[model samples]
Target: MTATATAAVIAPAPEAAPALRDTRPLRLITCGSVDDGKSTLIGRLLWDTKAVKEDQAAALNRDSGKQNDLGLPDFALLLDGLQAEREQGITIDVAYRYFATDKRSFIVADTPGHEQYTRNMATGASTADLAVLLVDARAGILEQTRRHATIATLMGIKQFVLAINKIDLINYDKARFDELSLEFKEIALSLGVKQVTAIPVSALKGENVVYDGKASMPWYEGPTLVEVLELATVRSAQTVGFRLPVQRVSRPGESFRGYQGTVAGGAVKPGDSVVILPSGMVANVKQIVTFDLVRNAAVAGDAITLVLDRQVDVARGDMIATIDAQPQVGLAFDAQLVALQPGGIEPGKRYWLKSGSRRQRVSVQPSSLLDLKSGKWNRHDGALPMNAIGKVHLSFDEAAIFDAYELNRTTGAFILIDPDTNNTVAGGMISAKRGDLGGLNNEAERVILSLPADLADKILASGILSERRDEIDIRRTNPGRAAELLGELDS
Candidate 1:
């Protein structure tokens, strides 16, 4: 990442993106293990791109704790802005920086590398379009590197840049670079991430980061880190449905009423029929109001006040989505989450589940834990320890609304807040909707028949009982328990 200064130049649009979007900047995050040079990598990029102002650069030089032997001031000072971080010589929080090249703009999050602050790393990764995972060349790949990469993949980031930092310390070895790149690529492939680009960088010396490192290594012919980011895919079109989690109902005057929120997924236009979630009241979109103009259409990420055809008792925390592609509404759902804080996730404890703007109480039961070392989801005891990634069952007292994370990121993601401490304990993604205990009208008339989930699914998908689907509640159970239930109910 460090080298002689050069003029910023425009880069051509990347081949991976559907179209190079100029409206929004490419958002990315830099992360890895402690002292992996995440901050230095970002700082070097910012400095090279001229994102650091003159006075700020002067201040950076003045306050740099220790200058490197290469004659450049410590670049890490640019991003490690906090006093605690400065004193400890480690990043404890996430710092975001915005910079631009002639070809594109970027929003980079410099996240903490320590295990205790993995929650902060998750928070930064939540909105990132790509992940630049820095690994010390001398250290190769560490457990924390794999952990961050796993978290980024789970957050839906497909593009990854394995920044093998401090390659200078390794004497710019080509064999070592290839070995590390292959190792990371294999790990990435196992996690279903195929868009992997490995770059050798020296953050303090500014090697193959913004400037080419051909002088040091003529054998390397790959593009610089900036070139890869300029072409990486930006727009995500994986969602088939529209989602607007209503943040508030805007009404400046009694004559006009509109629901205001940022579009979470898909696109909406006037006359589109949308169903209010939980209540399931259908209405047509009448107008889209924005500060700049009354738009005819709005897509995901647009902030607008949407007026409905008629008043249907819309309120905060309600979701407005396309009726034809409605999300799953049920009493229970399955989720995979990262246990964040030291307290971890306690089984059967009621916590506040905040998905979008809606927050409600739900009980969580851990089912399995992901073993990062082995890349497997193993059966875990009901409790999850800190930094543990586990799959869980979420039981709600009322109807729960979600789309599987694979379908819609906004509607499918959530965070669990501990009521006692009022702190976020875990960040999760909805996997699927499953049956729950007895949403039937009368418990006395209810038949508690258990069946294999696949069998129940087959019966429901057959359409023979489509009209009366709600009348017959399906609870999935193991094969042995299902057979036992069938025997007990025999005539």
Candidate 2:
């Protein structure tokens, strides 16, 4: 039986005590189009749960510090801290807020609802176990709804709650709810989204947000919003593998030194033999240490220090793994990407590639492009335009271990950094190597042109535009020029 089918079977229990017992926290990121109430939903969830402190609530209510034309406390204002977001009445960036009910603690990333902020939404969802997708009940599903949902699935958020918000405007009608649910279910399933639970909500009014499901809509039979979150299988989704991406080597003063980062996946126990990926160095975990305390083992969420048997040459951007499940290392990779910025990404462009803790220089060579809307792959496009997701063959300057993005998001996913500003420019899920392509191996191609001077010239000459000419002109330029230029250095 399917897990969703099993969940249906276990709906009825013998006791009235809370159905969910696990305290394993889930990270949720809210996504939708602008004015879809993404922030309001977050504020409402916090408000109804009494998670927001009394002082903060009081501060919001004060006459001197209030906002919005409605004057009824711009509930979204609680999250839209940026001056631009509040003034424009739109979310422009990703905002993180934490709250907890007795059943589950949540690290909620309230992402921007603007179409331009899809990259931010993907960034937030890249780490999320569940996505709370909001759709305005009055508007039904818009283009942004489908876009966010599709992006959510692409980022590997396995679970979803399709929140049909603004139900108050729809007269709390079951027929309208059913129609909207049916329409969204079709879209969700088409995108390979699983286990969707359509819920009617009024994030602005606090209906069926945390409690009082009895009074809002008796026709709805599912668990309340909080109940669903508390019972959802978040931990099982996260505990899939062992991935420790070294973010930094911690040597505070002379008293102690250790590795610092949130454990990405699986569990690590002291004395567990682990391997440093791309380096292949083996070491037994001497101890798992954290601020003010030490433990025998460390699981996900434990931001503790790990002491290895011997000091291997470890640093930021390296991955430590259990020897048996070490990640695959390659200099060349394929990725499906959506460009957000104005410039086009092309071959020989040196963007910072950050996977887990490891960041290295990567040169992109476009092999194909996928029209994300049609879900069709387009090979030979040679360039990815704004908001276009296409398969790209990329060559990295260094070999780093990569877990398939589907297996472990934290380790498998990566972001492209702007070499000039260091801002994350693109998000990617590491699929398979280009070996699958007929007689084309990016790794082999990179190796053949691995000369340092050749690589340098390529990096200097890649991107949408160059010092010399337009994007089209740059693509037309010969990369062989770099190899030919290397002869000058040799001479």
Candidate 3:
């Protein structure tokens, strides 16, 4: 019999609260290797929480065609809403679901587990507070599991739940659960994730998910999945100072000039001093406007129109930030990126880098590639293949604004768009400013390139030197200065 059929034979006990509940909606992503029961887990969470409406349940029943012995409709049917997913019995894209309990609410992202859809998983994870990484109890850990964990860490997720699912398949074996938990704890530590909860669950049976499974596994004494989610801490962006990347300048009227954008970090209020970046124009906040009542102040995640006290040359792509705490501004930076497209990220190739509301031209140079299996950085300076993570140096044509992703995720994250195809080729996080690599260096170590005037003009006009022209020094050779320089060199 299937796990769902077995669940019908078992009786559920009364539910009880484990601890004081947090009211904030916990945003989380469910991800793992393919066929790891991500869809079923989410469907069951929704079903047990009574989030599914009667009409929706009835539709699921009709679409599923057959019911398990427990009279439960195929739970996966509720989340695999796409026609292709329904036909293939797999989730292709990220499916978001909303459910609530007495203590808290949730916005769960049911992400595809397939390796090719890893980019979709990353997209979902970008906004999640916690990650539930599922694994079949019989299959220990796979490479895809490590990939998901690595990506989750790179995306700034600190809380993790290692769902050793299908525990029933192993006869509710406690030893196997302990072994997997120990192994995963090591992996979590390696990724700098200190908060990890491991649970043996039969998502197909609703065991240790919403309700306790003491009837079948009395030896286990951990909180259910719902309990852990209720108590998990939400990520906060208050530590980073205020940031507002201007999306557009509102000119509803000539007198009403307002800059509009979402607050990326910290808080802003009227009379606060702020600076416009790349241009470094300073202004004081006049008002915070919104569709509703004019807000006294705006915090991170608030979308508001900010009016400055003085007229300035502020435009889209410029950042309005606290003067004392500003984002890093430089021509070069270090970053880690996950190549998303099949074409991969080619070194020394120019791509469009978009962060916040600003997009600029940048050339990427690969520094090292991450080995998912060993969780080590291998020395590499080549094309970063799709799904590969690599450390790279980004050289920009203009001043690039960012923060270290470790400090503020909102200001630190960016995407690389291919100029030729206009497709997003990679997602990256700023590590640090490439400080002073171009600073005063030993002149004796510099290489000089000499060519005829026509050849040099051709090289400069070919766009190859367009990005590096500012770093190059050119001098016109003459009989007077040339001889004088040669004489000094001989001395």
Candidate 4:
């Protein structure tokens, strides 16, 4: 299937995740440095939750036979199923696991735990509702730990659970656990993480992972890993705004095709008035549809097709949402971009901006570079280098509606892809607009008079009537006089 076709079938969850108590399953992304037992911890969680199948459990029991240690289950094998992964005993690819308890269903993306593979971890964690960060108790807080925390924060993961694994190696000592917990707590808090719960676990022995065997440290007063995950409440966890980027316009068998997507937030009901973004085309939501189910109102996380009251020339890359909460439209907005590789982002290089299922052509104009180590935004360094996060002013080929990452992630978060290679070069979040920094007069007169007539029409239609009228007058007047008039208007 085409990229657009695949994106249409697979719904992308928007910014705010649903509540912990909601009907939707909790989706989490697990990230850690190498050998931190991210897979083992997750495997044990599944095992204890009774989500593991009998065949898988039997296979794990058989393959884990060591030369001296026999009959022990290789829990890691449950997730690291690839032959290369078993030979090396290190995760090299992302493995997705689905399991659920009586309380919540989960979709866990188990990412590689290597420093060099940090970019992959970022990709998985970007859409996570909560981040399960594993730290080796023996290693304490390493550089990679800080790196993962930084990426998690940058990716907008608000709730964090710091699972300090391999505690058995430290003899399950309270002093060691307390010391490490305090240190990691300070780091997590500094990263602006909303929640941090430190749990000591021997993923190898299943201590504190599932039931916290009596042989493990009894002095520990904290809940088991399973309890914390099942009981922890994340209030205001995610914004539930309505964001459905039209991934595809499909007409099956007859002329009955419709727009399809996974609802990111809010509810969509039949007869709800909606507007398609960028185009501003309005249509009534004719039906809340899915291949298997049709309903009056569909809430957050429902992957379904939408039948509009009228065929309003909708297409892929367009977004349809209720008229009440319209997305903010603009071509220029500030975004925080994090580079994954060594190459820097060239100021004038064109890239594809991927938000939800929508993609737009955009140019990266340098603004300020953020130094991750020092925690400061600096003047232009020509371009953003690898493993670096910076803020840039993006100029899109067309205006797109978006929300501030702080307000709604579905609309605020976006990915920058190389137009030539189609490789995702940068991950970004909309912070604010540069124009929002100054007075309204300066923003009004900042446009060029020579823009195409269609663009001029859009600027006029954007409801900034004064700017439109001023632009029209400038175009009709002499160039030198127009400059002077604009200067006066700004002043």
Q: Rate the local accuracy (lDDT) of all candidates.
A: 0.86, 0.73, 0.87, 0.74
Lowest lDDT block of 10, candidate 2: 468-477
Which candidate would rank higher by TM-score, 1 or 2?
A: 1
Candidate that would win on lDDT: 3
Please give, for residues 145-244, the per-residue lDDT of candidate 3 as tens digits.
9999999999999999999999999999999999999998998898889999999999989999999999999999999999999888889987678999
For TM-score, candidate 2 versus 4, the one ahead is 4
- Which residue runs of candidate 1 sit more than 4 Å off their true CA positions? 1-23, 436-491
Give the Cα error of residue 278 in candidate 3, in Å. 1.4
TM-score of 2: 0.75
Better of 1 and 3 by lDDT: 3
Runs in model 2 deviating more than 4 A are 1-21, 63-72, 212-218, 235-241, 247-262, 286-294, 303-316, 367-380, 436-491
Tens digits of per-residue lDDT, candidate 2, 109-133, equal 9998777777788778877888888
Candidate 3's clash total is 0
Poorest stretch of ten by lDDT in candidate 4 = 470-479
Candidate 1 residue 214 Cα shift, in angstroms, is 1.0
